[model samples]
Target: MGCGACMTTPRKKGGERREEFIYHRMDPTDVHAVARKHARGHYCLCPIHGPDDDADLIRDTYKDLGYRLNHTEFFMIRSLSRIPRVVSPVTLKRVTTIKMAERLAKTAARRQILPEHVDAEDPPMRVYVALVKDDIVGWVNSVVADKATYCGGMYVQPECRRQGIARALLAKMLRDDRKGGARQASLLASHAGAKLYPVVGYSEVGTMMVLTPKKK
Candidate 1:
């Protein structure tokens, strides 16, 4: 398969900047060249997705280039109609302003929010924040394409997790998407999310490895 990549420069927790090359369904033979080309003069992260059998080879190739495995995410999907509806105990509101998006990003430890995320006339993404009184406790977003919705950035505060905030957020998002005519929903889930998503009708369809350049 041909390689496809999207580049992003996101700041780490301590204000460190890193460039990421997120590759989707890349061919094994192209891994080394693509990574080396983009890794020059900056800290680089390569999250690669490919055939399951090539996973080990891809990891070894990256290791030789001073990249280490940071994490693995499961690619999951489910029919929107199958997602169970859940009621959030807290309030859920659409994020329609830069201020609201910024707060959600900071609270969720996510990347910076941009205008496209909260555009009034034509927003590319739909974000929902969970509110317990006035405090934003959790958030999720969805991007719809070709009758399918890609759900992501789901997060809840550490103290608020076990109270079903995630499930409620997911259900609300998927329910809205289904009503909007999206038949399928998909997301890349972390280990913790992998366990939770199944409860809302998601099934793992594939896996991807996230790698970062080894620090000196």
Candidate 2:
């Protein structure tokens, strides 16, 4: 917290005033503490109390967390994304209509969606799809929370398997989410997703499981 007193202020909907002091570019060299707070944790908007994308700030944040920023200004351990070739042109589209969800739901009801756990919905969720020549090749569902983004479902059509469509959809989804404002993205990687996340710049920081009771 050294450099100086920095505050983040965001205009309220009613044009009111609000302020917060989280972290700042000049905050001190012991950034590890700041990084620790953000380690496997929700990212706070820049601490300088303003809107800015500073490479120096990103570098310092990682440095504070004991993560080295390489010559390219990305985490030393992770590779900056290399845009993968699509192999074939597949249209990626956001499922703006509820119809798509309904479509997925119907497919789920028939157990066509790899995992049967995808059918239930509380308030329903947004869906994204990758289509080829009008055929549904892949789909993903996500819900956002204060701390993280939760991916509920990701399934590639059986016939489209092994064509790299799933990976393309995943990469597109993660990039879209990050662009939309996510400090970090996470998902309950299925058996297949566990293998894919790392390829797209996501590292395994934890594990997840489902608990259920058995009926005697």
Candidate 3:
């Protein structure tokens, strides 16, 4: 099934048309509403809980649920605030750098395989980066389908994890993506992301594994 309303065609079997919803840029006023939804577990976004009321149990809570922290994959907003002042910027930079490198590697890998499909000059993709106190803290990549968007790489630096920075960034993107006339957004999640994605309103489609050829 294709996303008749957006840019790309859907690749799923069921032909079920998942329409994207309204998108708008979230402002400060929206935070309260977002927090409320999170508190109720109805938000379906990550960090899967209300504002950090009990930091001590946060790790235990997820652990009890058998959720393992893909330390690198967890784009936690709460952790953003919890990070010590001295280390936040350094960590954010490391994350941004790794993310950029990964993107480049992925692009290089794709280039080698010319996929009988994509053009040599694939269009430039845009990813959003968010900062706390002017320090890079969170990031997410987005793609278009018809008018809708499929969110790609979403991550927050390890030192900045769990501090609501990611949530804030995501809320902003969802609003912006929708306002751009996108009806829906989707993304594949990592292990730690498994717990977070559902909290922010993403449902699992299935799983995938990537195997790359080793260097000769």
Candidate 4:
């Protein structure tokens, strides 16, 4: 498991150029060596609720990399019942169509989902697509273990952002989970997804920090 630690920012508030750090999770065993070859642009940091108070591991890991934890984010949990149904042109589809798979392949590089795995007759994971007037607009995937629904592969098209598609998909997700007899649902929310989850019944349950290379 990785942890967070931060360095001291310069006290000068005026005209001081602020440095930004992006977090990445990898084989933490050799971070200083591998990170240089495999870095990507940034995205939102997911919030965790209450984090472990022990800073020893986080402190020690970054100390070796010459970086420090800047801030800790809270991740959340919520009851499915807390999500209210939303009405929109977006209708949730249970299967991933050919276009859906291709669209995901082109834009979902960060998602790390295998193309073959997306359309198994009885996939080990459950997948759902969102449609806007017959065009695939978004999609999500989840797996149920220990009576909890762990979500992933949540994505919406760029052209369709801020139009309530993600929330509508989430609403369908929770609704279907309840019908499937699940008691609760959980997901690792990105900074972008955090805005939608809290509105449902999820609350901060833990914390995680991102690590990126320091500027040269």
Least lDDT summed over 10 consecutive residues: which range in candidate 1? 43-52
Worst 10 residues of 2 by lDDT: 70-79
Residue lDDT tens for model 1, 1-216:
444555556666767656566666565446656667766446444554544556787789778877788888888989975766587788888888888888877776774347676865645568888899879988888977868988857888898889988888888888888877889999889898899999989988778777776889
- TM-score for model 2? 0.49
- lDDT by residue (1-216, candidate 2, tens digit) is 334222323343456433322343444334334444433422222233222355565555545544442222011112223434444358887665545655655654422222322344322334577887766777876555443455656788888877777777766765555454545555655566677666656665433211111223
* Candidate 3, run of 10 with poorest lDDT: 1-10
Error of 3 at 64 (Å): 38
**What does candidate 3's lDDT look like per residue over 137-168, in tens digits?**
56765555665566656777687787666655
Q: Each candidate's TM vs. the true structure?
A: 0.81, 0.49, 0.42, 0.60
- The local distance difference test score of each candidate is 0.76, 0.49, 0.43, 0.59
| Residue 26 lDDT, candidate 1, scale 0-100 | 62
Q: Residue 177 of candidate 1: its Cα lDDT?
A: 82
Q: Is candidate 3 or candidate 4 better by lDDT?
A: 4
Clashes of 1: 0
The alpha-carbon lDDT assigned to residue 108 of candidate 3 equals: 30
Model 4 off-target regions past 4 Å? 1-57, 60-73, 96-103, 106-123, 211-216
lDDT at position 176, candidate 3: 53
- Let me know the TM-score candidate 1 reaches against the reference structure: 0.81
